[model samples]
Target: MPISQDRPFEIIVLGPPVSGKGTQAKLLAKTFDIPHVSTGQILHSIKDDIANPLAQKVAEFINAGSLVPDELVNQLVADRIKKDDCVNGFILDGYPRTLSQAQAIDTAVKLDYVFLVNVSDETIIERISGRRVCKNGHVWHIKYSPPKTETVCDDCGEPLFLRDDDKSAVVKNRLEIFHQNMAPIIEFYERAGILIRIDGEKHIEEVFQQFVRHMIYDLRNKVNRSSGGSPSGTATI
Candidate 1:
């Protein structure tokens, strides 16, 4: 559907770790003045509201370092998208992992697009493994944004160490698991003909621009086809 004020832009940004989908989602949400509905952030925020029973249950699972059940997650997401901020639509960062979850979302709202920020395994490994952080949680990539001092935080002079999760082996394992879970979800959206893949191994701004160009191009084509080949003058994003 052509994005308009009346029709909300229900979008999903999908990609493996370090694919920059989160960054692109944030950009799209900000540019479109919509909410970035990240399930991970939603789960984390719910932990603070100890009075709500749902929040309490979610906190228990989070605090115990266990994944929340899919049913609970689906319910949480359903409730989240009903909020006023999501009326104009929202960018979903990481909710529908399983086919069941995707179908659940389908019943709630029609997704405009699922943008896959495509990056090679080698690039993902390189991008993730080069990450370093300090005690204060300041992050820097050794290759992209190194600190003034080697192996140290610029702000506090604390030694920066590689996070266990950012290690090469751990990243590889995460990629394997992500693909296994994401394959069917990708296929589902692809079959529905809303999956848009864009190269993400470029500069962050370039990646965002590429996504926007694809969206505008495809949306204009759609409008043209629906309007019997004579596109409107305002056929722009």
Candidate 2:
């Protein structure tokens, strides 16, 4: 099916830490010729912008090592989606961490799809535990993308060390917290029938191919039917 120029595609990617949601979202945005709007990236960029009042408000909380309030996050997202770049469509990542945040966005826009990149807890642990970082902030995975020299960064030639957060215990703890926080939000989307689950344990390219196939299938079905149902299924591609 062809992408309609009449309506915008609003997509949201949700996943646990290290589940590759950000990468997948980026791919979707690029393929569809839309912007990848990542809240984490937005927050990081806003910290340095002293001119915008909202940026100043966001910076204060970030500098104080405090979580940005749901209201503020919703406002930021609402404002972001209103930008001219988002007129065609946008892929959203790293926002709506809570039920309130999700509901707030619900009022602002109707989403076409909400994809959850599902990976097993064991897979997440292995993926994160294998990560190593250099002092210069270069990242490498021991199993997937190993450095040219063991424990040495390819770019900086510095010794790579395991980040404290990458330890097995910490990864497990983060997974637990992620599930606890995301449960309600997931349920909300599931009820709305717009939630599609993708198996994230596959290789990166294969995972992206799954996304492409699913999008084509869903859009084609919607074009065929008078009232297309929610595309809810695990990606098999």
Candidate 3:
């Protein structure tokens, strides 16, 4: 069925940690002038709003540096998507980590697209292991965000240190856990026929441009088909 252009469309981005989902979602949301709702950020922002038993349990898990169960996460996402800002449309990131969560989301909102930024496990480890942060709030990637001078912030002249969590061993463990949880979710989106895979190993700007183009194309096709016109692949924005 063709999508209704009169109503706002929701976009769901699925990817492992450090696969640039957050960055890409932010860019797409900015270009489309929509809200970028990240579940992790949302939970962090509302950490003090625990009024119910479920919220208390979620808080406990978060405080323990563990992931919240899928059910609670889905409920949080569903609640957030009903807000006024999301009425116009929004990008969802870091939710739907399991097939059950995906089914719950299907009941809550219509996902126009499910974008998967595909990157190898090795690449992800390499990309995240070199991340460094400075005391002055500057971030640098050893391979990608390198400073002009080694181990020093180019802007603030502060010493740059690797985050303990960004170490290779920790990152590898995280990746393994993510794959174990995410494989079925990916399959769910695939069966839904809305999955769009994009190569994430490319430069950040290149990936952003490709995503924008795909969005425009998909929106245009949806609109055209809804109006009883022959579907054309061309899109203009």
* Model 1 lDDT tens row, 50-139: 765799889888889998988899888888877788878889999698889988887777788788889999999999999999999999
Q: Where does candidate 1 have its weakest 10-residue lDDT segment? A: 1-10
Point out where model 3 deviates above 4 Å: 1-6, 50-57, 64-66, 132-139, 147-164, 233-237
lDDT of 2 at 61: 95
lDDT of 3 by residue, 13-37 (tens): 8887778989999998888778899
- Model 2, position 185, has a per-residue lDDT of 99
TM values, all candidates: 0.87, 0.87, 0.82
Clashes of 1: 0
Q: Model 2 over residues 1-237: C-alpha lDDT tens digits? A: 222334458889999988899999988888898999999988999888878689889988999999999999888888787787887778889978999999988877888889899999999998999998999999999888999877899999999999998899998898889999999999999999988889898889998987788788777666556466554554455
Query: How many clashes show up in model 3?
Result: 0
> Using TM-score as the measure, what is the rank order of every candidate, best first?
1, 2, 3
lDDT by candidate, in order shown = 0.85, 0.86, 0.81
Worst 10 residues of 3 by lDDT: 1-10
Reference-based lDDT, residue 108, model 2: 78
Q: What is the lDDT of residue 39 in candidate 2?
A: 94
C-alpha positional error of residue 137 in candidate 1 after TM-score superposition, expressed in Å: 3.5
Winner by lDDT between candidate 2 and candidate 1 = 2
- Report the Cα lDDT for residue 124, model 2: 90
